[model samples]
Target: MLPPDARMLASQNIVIILCGNKKDLDADREVTFLEASRFAQENELMFLETSALTGENVEEAFVQCARKILNKIESGELDPERMGSGIQYGDAALRQLRSPRRAQPQGTQECGC
Candidate 1:
């Protein structure tokens, strides 16, 4: 059974969970960090937070989540054959070969004796 708030937003295999942390603002006016974390855990969603003031765990949170996703991909938990998960080759040399080539220097012959 899917979580109450879990809705299929896209046909592609993608799930996004939004959580708000940092309750130090007014305490009574904000959702507690633990509450947000628990909600994510209960729904099997990635949980992360950052303090814009102190920048605590901002980079770490992103890196950690990325590592987790990569690990899943490597372990075959996430299928690489999917549209966005497929391997991408960005070598410039391959791209150049596809385009029209310019005239080569006369001295530089293709045959290597």
Candidate 2:
């Protein structure tokens, strides 16, 4: 039973990464690599076992995530104008998309001009 927000986010076409951190202490791990990998495969998510202390696979995980995102961007699968789906926007691009019409003052019977 996923939360409402979780379901909503899942509905959006976005990348999901299942990263198991603290791989330095694998002996104490409850979730096995096979299980995590299989789960990721089933859910269409990227999986990476990372270790912050040893710095193993940390950079690679980031690079992999970035690559997936860039691929989506290049393919036009992720639209930046869709709004609020974790996409970064530029200020100039936003300004260009805004309505150019100016607002009229309220309660003015008619325009003097």
Candidate 3:
């Protein structure tokens, strides 16, 4: 179960994803997929496994999360204009998305683990 603070944040419609990282090191895994999946289901979180070494599902994880947030926003479940909602819009956000830099090596990429 999530702690009080986390539950409060979740109550605010914060998008949560349970990401199992370091999938490239599966041989050394301490938890089984069923165990993690069960936990995610109980917690109502989207679940995914990713590998920083191979960049597997890294981008997809973020994209899915973003889509959920956008859906909430569009359905009026979340109000970007509300104080402390932790959502913002405008040209700055678009500009940030458009800014680009040199790409990192795929094997060296690390996403929200």
lDDT of 1 at 110: 53
User: In model 1, which regions exceed 4 Å deviation?
Assistant: 1-29, 84-113
* Candidate 2 positional error at 98, Å: 19
Which candidate leads the pack in TM-score?
3
Q: Report how far off residue 64 is in candidate 1 (Å).
A: 1.3
TM-score of each: 0.53, 0.67, 0.74
Please identify model 2 stretches exceeding 4 Å from their true place.
Answer: 1-7, 90-113
Better TM-score candidate (1, 3): 3
lDDT at 104, model 3 = 73
Model 3 over residues 3-112: C-alpha lDDT tens digits? 55765864558888999999899899999999999999988889999998899999999999988877687677776667777776776555343233347788886442
Estimate the overall C-alpha local distance difference test score of candidate 2.
Answer: 0.72
Where is the poorest 10-residue window by lDDT in model 1? 6-15
Tens digit of lDDT per residue, candidate 1, span 40-89?
A: 77766777675556666666666766566455555555554466543333
Ranking by TM-score: 3, 2, 1
User: What TM value does model 3 have?
Assistant: 0.74
Q: Write the per-residue lDDT of candidate 2 for residues 5-109, one digit (tens) a residue.
A: 653764456777889999999889999999999988877779999999999999988888877766676566765666665775578765442343345689756
The backbone clash count of each candidate, in order, is 0, 0, 0
